[model samples]
Target: MSAAAVAEQDGRTGPLERPAGRTCRLCGSNQLRRFLDLGVVPRCELFLTPEAVAAPDVSYPLQVWVCERCLLVQLPPLFTPEETFTDYPYFSSYSTSRVEQARTLVEDAVRRLGLGLDSFVVEVGSNDGYLLQHLVRRWIRCLGIEPSVNVGETAREKGAPTFTEFLTAETGALVRAIHGPADLVIANYVYGDVPDVTDFTRGLRSLVADDGWASIEVQHLLTLVERTEFDTIYHEHFQYFTLLTGQRALATGGLSVVDVELVDIRGGAIRIWARPTECAMEPSVRVTEVLAAEEAAGLHVARGHDGFAEAVSRVRDDLVSFLIEARRAGKKVVGYGASGNGNTLLNYCGVRPDLLAYTVDRNPYKHGRYTPGTRIPVHAPERIAADRPDYVLVLPWNLRAELLDQLSYVREWGGKLVFPIPELEVVSPAPADRPLEHPVF
Candidate 1:
């Protein structure tokens, strides 16, 4: 094929070729190896506005590589923060679960850290102040470092006291001059979105006080590989992290991890707590155990690569087969949860409105908008009742249990629920007043 044709096929700005000479992001090693190449895909958080939808869709190549030295799994060269974060549309306040989770986290932090009026809490990439708002109400002095102007303004209006600029070393220095070091730095779900570990962590170290702590929530790479959660591999998520990689990167930036907690909030998450050297808490056994696991799993080398790719193939075949059979049987099928994972699965598997009429989400931002590349229209939860589909495909399979519990009303019509990941299963919802025998997932 011509170079232009290859570039189009790869969904990148240039031709498909191996990155040369440059060492790994964590460790300066040239032993990097190729892993999964997800082809060209659109940015996961770039939710299309109505007007933008009428224009051409922008897409880029999404190829992941494994750093032989540090075992960090990350995407190849892509856009910078300026290009990606300007007027970004994804807002955290849109989700009830997230808001509640943030509130709980703030409350827990206050109790655990002995945080009170004297402590200052700082949040990185605090989108729309979902977490900081909780701190504000608790009478704790908090500042939110947000990049997106639209999201930052919205949060400021909500009284988050946010700064509408990217958090960098220079920005951190400026903020420190005004507010001094912070007692807490929240890097929730924003760790993976950042491409540069050196810069981001340096900025984090500077903003946090000697006695302060930093808590970061990142998606577990182990879960991604084990569960075949390929849908999480999108443009926005620059890296899929294991504890080993995270620790190494943090230590290099003069921060030490004191604790690591496994959380169920976002599919599978690792909430890591860190502080400066003198105030560093002893690293938890979980941290060492995870690193050992990754080492044993051969994550540092190009191993277990085939199984993941094979699993993706099986999922595609199984889903397509199931959909065709259901259509042949004259069953109306629809999808649920118009999320980033859903978008990746739909676009990669070539699922469209034909196989599934539409998808639903609780977030209003995504309601009237369509999925990035697939053009699958997003509707509110009420549409599920108005046009009752025979089978509802749970795109965000991680939250299947929660969605099923809330959508148990569909069982009144004998409609069944479907989970495409792990495996496909048909579940009949329990009566409205009755409890479900099986959990939501």
Candidate 2:
């Protein structure tokens, strides 16, 4: 039986709720082939408290599949949008690197699009007004549509007009009616979280002006499979897109890609510049180049999804062995970055408080809470200095450089860093005599 059929037999909703069989979200194709199954995992962002941990925590199957028709990588809808993002704890402004990326994008958009005081910019899923706040500072008219009430309020406080509502076709029409069509629509890192990809793209088409363009950034599927980025495979991310699948998803909503840029953020990301289908603008050479690269990487076929299960299994076994050896050697191992990806990795590997003593995060909201499923206590960065662990497991390995620089003090005590993903390896601290080697894990 298919995964969806199994889910239905177990009285659960599968990834695609279809009558006949599971269908692709982008293209209504039921030829989905299951690739990797990460077992049941809780929502990555759902951090628990001491009281909540004592109670039952919910979890769902974290399986991934690739559509034969469009080759879109996706997970079944294990949780509703309201369940995942209503009072979300993640804030984009909390990370200096993320904030800088947003500011840089805003500067480029303003210059490239000739955005003036009259230009209206609308950002879908604008968390804490990180990007739109830059526009507000330049005295430009802007609006943010954030579903999370807490993050929306923060955006409002930062002087960016925000609507705490999920962006749907209806919401898009409503925004267009009130603020008129947007000159520039930004959907940074929000595309993957959208459950209904078709409706979200339609909303984008509705909210954007005829001449306006939409900029979307989604983690690349090539990077996910090649780098064995299993930690990013959480219930919150409904679909993983390659340039081919991304173009297919956008085309369903009367949008066409004009340019595509490969970025290093979020491990590996593709920034797509799309315009209305009716627009006569030809796609830039960059778009063709990216599509070619995806084709060469076997992303357009089922082969691209192959070997992923084995890769994830190897990482899991290696990590578990590394942790076991560390504990056996009388070393204290703790984690840094109490992030959603960290939660996924910890829960997948079944690493409990016994294996990973604790973790520290800069986000004040998660300081006193515990990680979902694993129930590892989260403390502030200052706690790291007090404990002085022998090995600090860098959970959010994507931000290794920034985190390494921030926690370099661990080097003073001869503490080393551990990266679980890509491979299990221990990174030695930089010698006091010279600059850090910055070893690539």
Candidate 3:
């Protein structure tokens, strides 16, 4: 974005600038191409206090880059982990489907790995005991390594043993030394937050026992491209991964991919299983199959994503046009979730309160605060029913199944829900209010 536009939005006076170009985070290759640019956006998770909202927010260039050599797609790491995670407000326990997903993972791991009271488990970015709490109930010795001090404390309060620190090589080894190497190491959605994939994967390797398995879950780059999920491209996520690039990232730390599982959550994701290179099993057929699919989709090369930027812009334009038409038709549209991806979509399309009005969220921490960049007011979910708006825009579109059921009450007053990404669609709430499926981002 130009400095003039930023100045008008955030009340800044001076000229704004951001650095460009960097080596690939995985291979350190200067041979990289930018595939998508979301323009200048603030850190999405950085919610503003009432006072802070009155001040201008610092923003950065939101662009996606791909390495020619390694085929790893990334964002320039302009924001540090400290800037992104210190007082992180996203608690994983807020979504019931997500908690059930965690429980299923624990059950599967316990059965497959023969976990018992003596087995030790570790989770990086374990927010509010969403996963480890189930292990604690099973009498499994587990520890949570969390970066956010606020949510880490909540994990401890829930009887989940949590250590507040970002997992680096030293910190991972330190945790291993103090609590012993883990039988199972689980990382869900944290890989995107680490700017240095080499250090983070090494940390994952150091934390695992010789014969143990580590499962890292991240949104698949192929799915991102196919679905046009540009909203997921934010400052907090340093990179996007396919099985090929993902394996390269693991090998940096002497870990080898053994198998892969694709789950229908967060647009679509991969549950990657790896072990130390020496003891790692032969690659599973699933791995071969997924790699084949990615290759067929032209995702194994840097230029395969050539038209992603245009697709992203098309979605942005369509949504903006729809919202503008709704406004002219005398319709009211309020957002349903004050989510990070939602903020990306909002700011990229230049949707201010005049376009979105106030939004609602399930997490209480955001109730009185405002979304970063867009500065949209957040309220409790109950506000939707009380206000009876004509439309409730679903920001977290990945939670479509659950949200459809949750917002079914909107149908009481003939109100509808709007989904903005992939394509613009406005529809009545789910008719039956079905139960939530056990899938989560």
Candidate 2, pairs of clashing residues = 15-76
- Give the clash count for model 2: 1
lDDT of 3: 0.87
The predictions' CA RMSDs to the true structure, in order, are 5.7, 5.1, 7.2
The alpha-carbon lDDT assigned to residue 292 of candidate 2 equals: 88
Tens digits of lDDT, candidate 2, 272-302: 9999989838999998888888888877876
Q: Which ten residues in a row have the lowest lDDT in candidate 1?
A: 432-441
The best candidate by lDDT is 3
TM of each candidate vs. truth: 0.89, 0.92, 0.93
lDDT ranking of the models: 3, 2, 1
lDDT for each candidate structure: 0.79, 0.86, 0.87
TM-score of 3: 0.93
Stronger candidate by lDDT (1 vs 3) = 3
Off by over 4 Å in 3: 1-21, 432-441
